[model samples]
Target: MGLDAFAAACCAIPVLASLLAVRFAYVLCRSGLPPTRPRAAGLRCLIVLGSGGHTAEMMNIITELQKDRFTPRYYVAALTDSMSLQKAQVYEKSLIQGEGEKIIKNAQFMQIYRSREVGQSYITSIATTLLAVLHALWLIIRIRPQVIFCNGPGTCIPLCASAFLLKVLGLGWSSIFYIESIARVKKLSLSGLLLYKLRISDQFFVQWTQLQQKYPRAQYAGRLM
Candidate 1:
């Protein structure tokens, strides 16, 4: 290539990169802002379920949600968490009994790889976490949910991160709502802390006023459980 052409290409490369970076930053900042769009019906919702009490608390919240507005609901749990999945299924069955067959048809269940198993060493967890993140990216891309609801759960980090990536790229706008586990009175759980620190969740809620004071961004909802 000619010297002038080579020089121009090199200059354009940095300019293009800088422009892309600016665009990315702008998108990320805008994503955290309160959405101005008017509420619409039939919005897609994705709910992440954790084990035991986390699942129970989330189930209670789900029961209170306007089912008609959040159509085509998707529930995701860790692959090894059979109990959580079962609980979700039972909850859906109850909805069907109370509502109708339409409720069952609108709901879907999915399982994702756990980022780290209980008591697993951090050294080994790195690999598992990467795998989990990749799986989460695929799931997020496929689902492209408008609303994501997750309580404190390690499984949620990867999914939320993937959703945030989509938002930054301007590919999707997933409004993430995270609620800290009710058991955490004075502090946030690891998942909640990460989501808060990274500004990934559009809305973060805590059950205790003290916790909300400590984490200024967290909204105190007064014992959601």
Candidate 2:
């Protein structure tokens, strides 16, 4: 209320912010995922899982891969209409509003959805995952991607399943990364998960310590940005 009080409060703000950031980082680092071994071969095609913000990140990676040597095409396994799905990607003409925002994207892919009216994320994720399985299977038969990389937005289960099946026969991507969105900090709700097996890929990425511990076979080794 007074000048001295105001000055003290202002001084504490930075300290509070620093403390929060430290806690966030600790949560991330403490997350326990299985150690991932790097692949011995070069990457080829890619299969992306989910949509929204995380999907965009995978697309950015695909664009970079295309420019280099990998012939990258993506199968987007998530909820979206074909047209709106097109809009979901970052365009070359997209101008960013701030420094950290991405403005350009490149990756041609297909989308498989759960539902638009569904409000329960758990159910929706399972449905999307199953749909993604069918879609990815079809793509694998056709394009036969060398690698299937999933950028997570809860639709990782099916894509990875498809890849695992492909790998069983020795015809799929060598590494799979489940890049966590800021929203994927989930507590364990189910006892034995029917989904979230995540056993296919050579690498798995997550930002939550709880999930990291739950799935002790995944690698908590990287960030998306």
Candidate 3:
């Protein structure tokens, strides 16, 4: 076979495998994802961790979480870029006016990062990841919240890691990753890969049907805007 033909054959196998896995995952999620509603009553705190548009959605969920019987204690924000922080600030008044959900912004060097592109972004990302882990560990130690909710930024890496550790030690609260999109081009996203690897979030609420096929573990939540 010619060189081009050989390359096509090699690529074809992985593509076919990916397709099969997608099909298998679709069948799995068609049954539905694991139950995510807080099993216990009186959830002391619900940390809404996201900055941009995702943060808006998180805020909505935070509202949902607060509506429950418990009466929330804090709304910890580890914001990403400045824009996200601005978006978060807009909700500051709403957060305070209610049952005293403290809107504390704890953005360490690692929790917030920006660069033009990939390349060394990975190296900085690692630093960012380490800092986030330390921040998470420290927060979990200090706040001792019943749950750490995530609408990922690079900041989430450490928090998720620390929360997972806490759970193992039998001292941690619940950690959740609010998966906004199921079919994002993974090869193009550092955060997405991190979410997949950490895998700590209790449930992944997928917003698309095609995505459910790609991520078999994800629970299809239907379409998102």
Candidate 4:
């Protein structure tokens, strides 16, 4: 009787895992649909900012966002990226000036550790990457944002992965939108490639028509910058 129960449990494990995987895949497939209207409280949004040009382009895109709908915005950047945070703060300040105290109360900024620094040894990067992912998971759980917006940034990889995990576990449903950098005319950035190949992003956009042709899943939005 004990041997039979053990065998049954072993068989059940794989079956349960397979069902979870199927459910997760269905969720991913359905993610592309337009989200329903938010509650009267509004939707929480998480925006991941990269360094330099990446930040500039993202700011441009976000500037057009309806501040009232995507309320309680959370801006995330790399721990080492003070400049990007500063830029985001500046943008928030502009919002405050235009929209008043409500905008000030609705904005939040956060920083996450980078997975792998440039020139870091790959051996060491593995450990650092794991740490980053763990930190990202904690942040995602804490925020539980309804929408996640990011462009070409390595910093976003961990956050998006954490959000996807939450979705699979039936913990949260953070819609992830990945926009390729405007500079990537011929190919997707490494970060973009990973998200694209993994199908982790609910919506993927590219500026170049060539990239759209090459990646049918990516929508061509023209030069956003």
Error of 1 at 60 (Å): 0.8
Model 4 over residues 121-192: C-alpha lDDT tens digits? 999999999999999999999999899999988999999999999989889989899999999999999999
TM-score of each: 0.89, 0.53, 0.59, 0.92
Strongest candidate by lDDT: 4
| Candidate 2 per-residue C-alpha lDDT over 177-203 given as tens digits, one digit per residue, 9 for 90 to 100 | 545554556643121132345234455
Error of 2 at 55 (Å): 2.3
Model 2 vs. true fold: TM: 0.53
Candidate 1, residues 75-164: lDDT per residue as tens digits? 999999989878877888787655654448888999999999999999999999999999999999999999999999899999999998
RMSD of each: 2.6, 21.0, 12.6, 2.3
- Compose the digit string of candidate 3's lDDT tens values, residues 112-168: 322222355676676755665666688667666655565555555566566656655
| Candidate 3 overall lDDT versus native | 0.54
Q: Model 3 segments beyond 4 Å from truth?
A: 1-41, 66-70, 79-92, 95-128, 175-177, 182-189
Question: Which is the better candidate, 2 or 4, if ranked by TM-score?
Answer: 4
Candidate 1 lDDT score at position 153: 82
Which of the numbered candidates is closest to the native, going by highest TM-score? 4
Ten contiguous residues with the weakest lDDT in model 1: 94-103
